[model samples]
Target: MGDVGPYPWLRAVLAAFAEEVRGLGPVLDVGCGPGEVTAHLAGLGVDVSGVDLSPKMVEHARRLHPRLRFAVASATDLDLEPGSLGGILGWWSLFNLPREVLPEVLASFACALVPGGHALIGTHVGAGDVPRTEAYGGVPVTWTTHLWQPGELGELIVAAGLELTAQLQLPASGQLRPQVLISARRAPEIAPGR
Candidate 1:
């Protein structure tokens, strides 16, 4: 993704954050619009693969990031086998998911992650379900369902078997709203004590 104002800075910050972190292995860049982030990770010597909902985006990403693997796939029903990923990076993707389908998609992410794997997702924070019909790059775009509360998002991820670790509240700017940067990890196992 190209820098839309401060988005470039945010991207840089996210890159630095990932690099300094340890323990994560191969990563799944979900909703990899143009594979820029995937390519960035590959440049850092991280094993990275990407998946996007748009075929055009997939083709563009493949062209831009020839060293990384990318596919046109839905987040709700990824074709990956169980325990296949070490981490997942979902950039502003959860907002695009319909409320009813969120749980199913979260499960897909969880199933693909290996034990102890983590996922970082960027999403809008609202007080109630927000119905926003907006335009992206001059294209008419409409997001079906968006969560308004942090608790709702927490419940969604926890239900998918991921434990919440952190949440970053991005600043709201212009017509664009801020989002919650959520990071969560998959538990290794259910403790016998529990």
Candidate 2:
């Protein structure tokens, strides 16, 4: 959060994926907490915007990246027109939702994309949702962090009309939690050729 930036490997991987959809259209940074990654993509020459459910978070993002766009919105019910976005970044955010809510959110993500639009989703790896009452840095906090098997989340993404392009299960390292990073793409149209 707060533009602290992602782990080196994670940052490199995301940047590479972002480059794949560079000229397609704007990328929606769903749950873009403090615009860190959103700013990263923008620096990479990709058209990007940030969206988070919390107004405070959006405010922080706006302050941090005033020239970029940041909106307060829910991933479960996006305001975007169908087939409008080129890519989506759901980094370390989807796991905060209940498992039952994922499909709807994933569907919404798919609907907000143009044909061939791409999405990169990241989440923790485990079996159940864990609730946390205290913050690590002494700040008060209340939230449940859900975990999932990579295959399970991939299945949900595929069911939501996007084709799963790749899935990476990274082992825990240093202070970072083990994570699952998934990349998917909306099916593109075939040209009249052969």
Candidate 3:
């Protein structure tokens, strides 16, 4: 419920991913809390658009990052047209989505992108949505979903047609416990000439 920085190493890893991935365009930051990562990507010179489920959070993001595009929408149902995005960053969002709904959520992510697009998903090592025992900044909300193993997360993305790229886990905040991270890309169709 507070703004958190991308872990130092995670930042470096993401930067490297950006450098290596060619032709990525205006990005979609899913679960883009207050749009920090979206702002960071925009700073990197990549055009950016973002979507988050929280209107207050989205409003806060819009105020802080008016230069970028954003909307209040579900990751499971992005309003964008097909083949319109270059990438997606689902940082700690799907945890709120039930496991049964995870695949559909990912399928929606896939539908929002063009071939060769990229997505970077972040998750915890073994915890589902923390309950809404309290509110953050006056907004009452509940966390959703469940813990996922490495292979399970990977399988979901692949089933949605996104290619697996890498998985990186970082220690949790204020502690050294591990958190699971998943990075993936959507593959393009094989061309006839090939």
Candidate 4:
């Protein structure tokens, strides 16, 4: 996935997201492994930075895209300023989080975004967790892949106070499970005496 750029559909989604958030505030790419997507948004002229749980991945991202900001941080422990971000991206990143932890994370995304800010998330589509012992190129790893049905994830997003704006579902192909991309936005704040 790192060798190839984002798929056509994903590129389109990301382009629209970048356009929506331009000049609103900085965008954070959570779980930004290797920083490819972060760089893509930057190329599209977005004010974007990236964070990942792995220090090694952060190092790689820094080396690969020196102009962009990359940090070692967990999605569960992000120190986001309230209403500071214009957008957030969880592209194929949050599925490893425990089911119970996801809602809290989503709520934080809601709290961290300025009114009218948007979050775009993509995840594998399925039911329960699939524990993995190896990853790409047979690299040994220990993590659980937690999957969600589209409706279930959408409900969680809405429950976190963001309004669902769009959903794209992709069917399973070859070794890959089906996946879903969802976009949600914080409602614009209302003025007093409206």
Q: Select the stronger candidate by TM-score from 2 and 4.
A: 4
Candidate 3 displacement at residue 82 in angstroms? 2.4
lDDT by residue (1-194, candidate 4, tens digit) is: 33226478778888899999999899999999999999999999999999999999999999999999999999999978999999999999999999999999999999999999999989999999999999987999999999999999999999999999999898988898999999999999899999
The per-model lDDT (C-alpha) reads 0.75, 0.86, 0.74, 0.93
Ranking by TM-score: 4, 2, 3, 1
lDDT by residue for model 1 (6-52), tens: 57656664665466333466788888888877776676666788899
User: How does each model score on TM-score?
Assistant: 0.82, 0.93, 0.85, 0.96
CA error at residue 114 for candidate 2, angstroms: 1.0
Candidate 4: 10-residue stretch with minimal lDDT: 1-10
Please provide, for model 2 over 1-194, each residue's C-alpha lDDT reduced to its tens digit, 9 standing for 90 to 100: 22336567677767777777898888999999888888989988989999999899899999989999999998877877898889998988778888889998899889888899999999889888888776557767788988889998999999999999888788987866788889999999888893
Is 2 or 3 the stronger prediction by lDDT? Answer: 2
Clashes of 2: 0
Q: RMSD (Cα, Å) of candidate 2?
A: 1.8
Among all windows of 10 consecutive residues in model 1, the one with the lowest summed lDDT is 1-10
